[model samples]
Target: MTVQLSGRLQAIADLVTCRAVLADVGTDHAHLPVWLCETGKIKSAIAMDVRKGPLLRAETSVRLAGLEDRIQLRLSDGLEQLRAGEADSIVIAGMGGILIRTILQKCPDRAASAKELILGPQSDPDQVRRQAQNLHFRIDREDFIREDGKYYPLIHLIPGEEEAAYAEEELFFGPCLLRDRNPVLKEYLLRRMRTTGQILEGLKKHSTESSRRRAEELGKEKRLLEAALNRYEM
Candidate 1:
């Protein structure tokens, strides 16, 4: 039987390039790795999670899928237990952007060795982009998915040299997604625009210096979102 993944996890799995040794960081149930392995997308995988409970769940899933030999379960904090050259591609998903950044920061050499880095940050995606750029991982592709009334972006990066710098809009919104003019991205931007407008309106009632500065920041962000939306003729 095939392992079923949620829309969010399926979106992340879809971004994985096939036929590589895969490592799924924070693999709560090891669903992604199991699906990939069971489907013959990848021959081997490392299913890792920080918490023992989650790792146990992953172990059970791996056993139930009859992929215990192919999918190795490890209790690891980020890439700490993983060595370089162990995995060709790494999937770090379902974590906050800041935590993801920290994971990459802690293991530069191991992370750089991977051919691909697929990241799904739950919050502060821009920070993830910035961190990846700083590590010289050029974004190969980006995708957006709306699941459970929430928007999530999947960033695919590869080790490469950067030819140019990303603008504020490109950094805030993914460069590939912006260029693709994804409808989901447009919807997300419009939602952000509406939220920013509300924040700006609330700031107007306060005359404090901090509120004024915050309002200015939000106004700038609102304009950026508007520009992005305009590109899609939305």
Candidate 2:
């Protein structure tokens, strides 16, 4: 049998190297935990979800993988069922930035105990990064992956504050992605720049200052993106 995850989720799993157990919050199919345990990435893991339906699915997957003992399924909301220091690593994926922040806020102590945190928010990654920053979680690493025509950012963090603040440009365009200059990342940004430029052009027809300002920001992004592409080409 073969187990697989979306490219973004697999990238998240590849980011951290921890010897301790993992708690995959919002684990829908329990694939991440099962893969981790099956591949010896983690000794064991707890697959948790808010509802019973997904948890049941996770249970079945675990059983089919013959890992019922190694992968425990928990029915709880967010990290409510997880205790502080229960797991050294926590992974939260396939959720909105607001919900992810809410989960972290509800379990601030758990965040403190864990050595690493891997989060993949479906939207508004800047808001998520800001929340993590405010919580004194220093970014250990970040990656961007494309799957099903959508761009996903996988962020890893630890309990500490950043020495220097991240700029708006850095926040909107992931710092790691900007620095890495991966071809796929550049392609994604280029597409975004073009799409936003078109929107900005359309909004300019309405003659609103707010829209104009946003358009100008988008224009700047277009230029920045072009420069990044140029730099990468060189």
Candidate 3:
């Protein structure tokens, strides 16, 4: 059976190392693992979700994909149900950045087992990047995609921290994406610069201490984003 993934999931799938055994956290309908297995990108997979409802649905999808033997479905919170070294790659997608950070932080053992981690954090990607560094996993590559009017940043991190790859602003955006000069990211930066400018303008109307401080912060952010965008001009 052929499984077509949405743009966001497809972007995340593209980051998975070829032929890697998979552990898909927040598997939801288990679309990714099933598609990967069907396409021969993976030999086996464990599709996990925190909710029984999703796990059951995943079970049905796996059964229909005729991958019941290759794909196992589990009800797991984060990586809690996964054992160390059980899989070659771990994927946690469609989650808030903070929760993804928490999952990695809470399951160092499980995380250490994988050769790669494919993460797609819905928000606060900077925090996710910082946490990955704290876990000693440097980004192998990264991508930013716009799906349905929202932006999703994908990070592929492998165990070990290396020298600085990009400017510290990557913590605010992404290292590989910045290095690649991804046009989608350029679009996102422009939109954010406009938003920050608008907020700063509103903050200027109020001269309270907090307003002033917020304006200062936004001003800095505006400048940083502009600098990142400037690289695209070169």
**TM-scores for candidates 1 onward, in order:** 0.95, 0.88, 0.94
Clash totals, every prediction = 0, 0, 0
Worst 10 residues of 3 by lDDT: 161-170
What does candidate 3's lDDT look like per residue over 53-136, in tens digits? 999889888988899899988888899999999999999989899999999899988997789999899988888888888878
Global CA lDDT of candidate 2, please? 0.83
Worst 10 residues of 2 by lDDT: 225-234
- Which pairs clash inside model 1? none
Query: Between the candidate structures 1 and 3, which one is better when assessed by TM-score?
Result: 1
Model 1 CA deviation exceeding 4 Å by range? none
Which model is ahead, 1 or 3, in terms of lDDT?
1
| Candidate 1 local lDDT, 1-234, one digit each (tens) | 658989988888788884879999999989999998988889999999999999999988989988878988888999998999899999998989999999999998888989999999988888899999888999999999899898888999998966788877887788889889988998899899889999999998999999999999898889889878877873
Tell me the tens digit of each residue's lDDT in model 2 across 1-234.
347877877898898689669999999889999888888889999899998899888988898899988988899789999999999899988999889989988888887788888989888787888888877888888888889888888889888988888866567666676767766778877797779778877887887788778878778777766665555665
Ten contiguous residues minimizing lDDT sum, candidate 1: 225-234
How much does each candidate deviate from the true structure in C-alpha RMSD?
1.5, 2.6, 1.6
Top TM-score: which candidate number?
1
Q: Better model by TM-score, 2 or 3?
A: 3
- Considering every candidate listed, which one attains the maximal lDDT? 1
